[model samples]
Target: MMSYQQLLDQRAQLEADIAAARAAERRAAIAQIRRLMSEHHIASHEILPRRAARRARLLEGEVLYQDPVSGATWAGRGRPPRWLAGRERELYRVNLESQDSREGR
Candidate 1:
């Protein structure tokens, strides 16, 4: 039988392994999707919302779909709006720092 400490250690190891596997899966999925897009000539940016991220850090953040062939980010101008990239995170910080809204953006 495993001791309590040993069991805890095993649990931690399993959790870590699971997390690593999930990251690998995400990377693989990204690659496969890119290949499919290329094969099909799909043109569009991926607008992913940071749902799992901290509400403060998520400020309107989105992963602009990048061109797989050219390695340039989407949004036609060689990338999405710079400020829009992490607007959500900024908003979260502002909301945290400003107790009362006296200043307006």
Candidate 2:
């Protein structure tokens, strides 16, 4: 029974009412959250969880083992080199001379 313009106006008014209601709801929620935070003595930082970042790979430190003949080096980290599998670890121990040379000695 309403005119087209009246129907359009009603729809616009309804949309505005919905928007206002949503705004009020959001305000209420924020007020409730603030109250809860104050009641529990919760800080903003405490509300959010701390992120644990992956540790970065460090610089390779001093070498622990080496092959004198081939000059291959290992820092004694991770898996041992294939050539060192059956050999005595002391036999492949990195000498002070090699370390010093690497350090510009």
Candidate 3:
């Protein structure tokens, strides 16, 4: 029969061995994944698609109209806002030249 101290020491050793084994396995798995990715010519973006790319495309157009009261902007892609309702949309059309100059274009 092992003493209490001896059993505790054995448990500690077993835990250390388990941790080492886990680390080795993780390293091997990472290496295997890198090798497979290289062989298949897989890009990181292909695996993890960018939501930012889609959002950027959606917001590609410049601001076409703005509300003078609230300073709200719209790209004129979707339905007109309430501020522009029953109003001439051309009245709120953004001046491209002034906008470009403000942006240091």
Candidate 1 vs. true structure, TM-score: 0.44
Who wins the TM-score comparison? Answer: 3
Q: In model 3, what are the clashing residue pairs, if there are any?
A: none
Better of 2 and 3 by lDDT: 3
Per-residue accuracy of model 1 over 30-67 as CA lDDT, tens digit each:
99988988888875443333553434333434223444
Model 3, stretches more than 4 Å misplaced?
51-105
lDDT tens per residue, model 3, 1-105: 999999999999999999999999999999998899999999777865678665664487678899999999888888988889899989999998897788775
TM-score of each: 0.44, 0.45, 0.46
| Candidate ordering by lDDT (highest first) | 3, 2, 1
Better of 1 and 3 by lDDT: 3
lDDT of 2 at 96: 65
Question: In model 1, which range of ten residues has the least summed lDDT?
Answer: 91-100
Candidate 3 Cα lDDT to native: 0.87
With candidate 1 superimposed using the best TM-score fit, by how many Å does residue 17's alpha carbon deviate from the native?
Answer: 0.6
lDDT of each: 0.56, 0.80, 0.87
lDDT score at residue 82, model 2, on the 0-100 scale: 88
